[model samples]
Target: MSGISRRKFLTCTLVGAGATALSLKTTDAFASAKLEGYPDSMGVLVDLGRCVGCRSCEAACNREQHLPAPAQSFDDPSVFDQTFHNGQKRRTDEQAYTVVNRYEPTATDQPVYRKSQCNHCNEPACLTSCFVNAYTKTSEGAVIYNPNICVGCRNCMIACPFNMPAYSYSSATNPVIKKCIFCYDTRLKNGLPPACVEICPQQVMTFGHRKELIEIAHERIKARPDRYIDHLYGENEVGGTSWMYLAPAPFEEVGFDTTMNNEPIISNVKDFLGTVPMVLAIWPALFTGFHLLATRKHDIEQHGDDHSAHKEEEKKS
Candidate 1:
């Protein structure tokens, strides 16, 4: 409306749509592809039954990552009783990459403690959503982030189903996302387990190749059916993840989202995005045909007016 004619406006709209589609083509390719992950990628298997809520893993992660000291010390048991707004469990934040949450299931008197962190999916939504390519899925099965190239879009946060990635809001400048990267730089790339896995006294986590861990988890469950649930969380959820869980209680009771289907989060998004390019391609030609028809009609009207004027001039002569 800002001094733009109808044809010019339509032309701009078509061009903009086409440009958007072109930009998203690369993202669609990443989202739609079947990513089975590296064959020898490392993974962690969390046994919920073994965790004692000792907070040693939290302390180890804090020391290993060199994060700032929390208001509540890692040694304090009061952290387990803490909850955020809406009575939600404490999640990973700028300060804490991993947090242990206590869940009291009605089925058992003993409370279940769940360690929350980045699951590092085989086909990560964070990697697909980041337009700037800030997120990367390592061949070692770690989902790492590059803050140097990050535009502070936080698209990864929304894309992650686990709600793991946290932004560093405390830094007024050069703030970046903070989350567990499986200790890629210090230990994982060197073929060592994470600090949390090593420091845990109860042996709550088992670090090994992803394929081998799956087999081990199934074996453990089969040997003790009464002690574990049949389902292995993260085995197929969101197209599988690097980290998996074996719990004695139902997953829902331990704060897992049970409604998610086996398909990756980006799969449906890619399906919708796939049509956008086709629509953009068709619209330009379709609207150009309309513009041509309108211009031809205008030309015909101008010719008719000239003919009328000529007839009037001839009559006057």
Candidate 2:
């Protein structure tokens, strides 16, 4: 019988296990036990009508995070003219944790400025996708990451539903995932608002408990139905986010992806995640058995060859 060495067996087993995990169907436990997040989690409510496209939040965020200087001054309005291929506006990157985008939807008479950052989902896909446990969801509704334990796999970048995570590709020796942490270390945990929120000249953002923010957002819409859109952008999107939006125009026209379902991104792959532990525990023993069987088969073949030679010697005698 053809035999496989222990090394080859282990390699093939790992590959097979990964493929199997990816193709698995959703399990009942994961489907049934959906996480709604902490009841008292803090959040931010952004009123787009109040935003003046000044980008004060961006400047404050940059200063607070001590990030690299930008290509243009934060006060420069020319940055609003910047657009990528297919007309995609600026997004978060290694240098900038937050960005304000200018969207001129036909429905609105004036330009609608939208601030973009990590939504800090209740059940983040990045947190679930990381095998190293590098991401954490704090009770304060902050989704923070640890660069020390990050393997630099870039899995978080691909797994993020909002495309918020960015890799520090410029660093040659050590690169890690970077994203907005809701100012957990500096301000949010200390019971103070984020730097961006505090610096907004127009008072565009309101910070408080998530549930309270939801009520406030609804109250604003109800009070001025003609001025604001009826829908709250992030209230139920992707299993509810720590940061929500109250836009004057349709969310889709303002660069918001309205088609995203309310279910958490992790729910789609929970079955795969659930089986990882089992694979780690069982595969070593199973492959060790394969190695033992292969070794025994090799010994049996050698013994048969020896017996055949002895019979031939007897015939010659």
Deviation from truth (RMSD, Å), model 2: 7.7
Best by lDDT: 2
- Error (Å) of candidate 1 at residue 79 is 1.1
lDDT of the structure predicted as candidate 2: 0.89
Model 1: colliding residue pairs: none
Predictions in order: lDDT: 0.88, 0.89
Model 1 lDDT tens row, 106-184? 7667999999899999989998899999888899999999889988789999999999999999989888888999999
For model 2, state the Cα shift of residue 131 in Å.
1.4
Off by over 4 Å in 2: 1-26, 275-317
| Candidate 1 runs further than 4 Å off | 1-32, 278-317
Q: What lDDT score goes with residue 257 in model 1?
A: 92
Model 2 C-alpha lDDT per residue in residues 1-317, reported as the tens digit of each score:
24666765677687667655643532555667888889879999999899999999999999999999999999998988999989889999999999998999988889999999999899999998899999999999999999999989999899888999998999999999989989899999999999999999999999999999999999999999999889998889999999999988899999899899998888787667777776686577667765766576577789888888899999999
The pairs that clash in candidate 2 are none
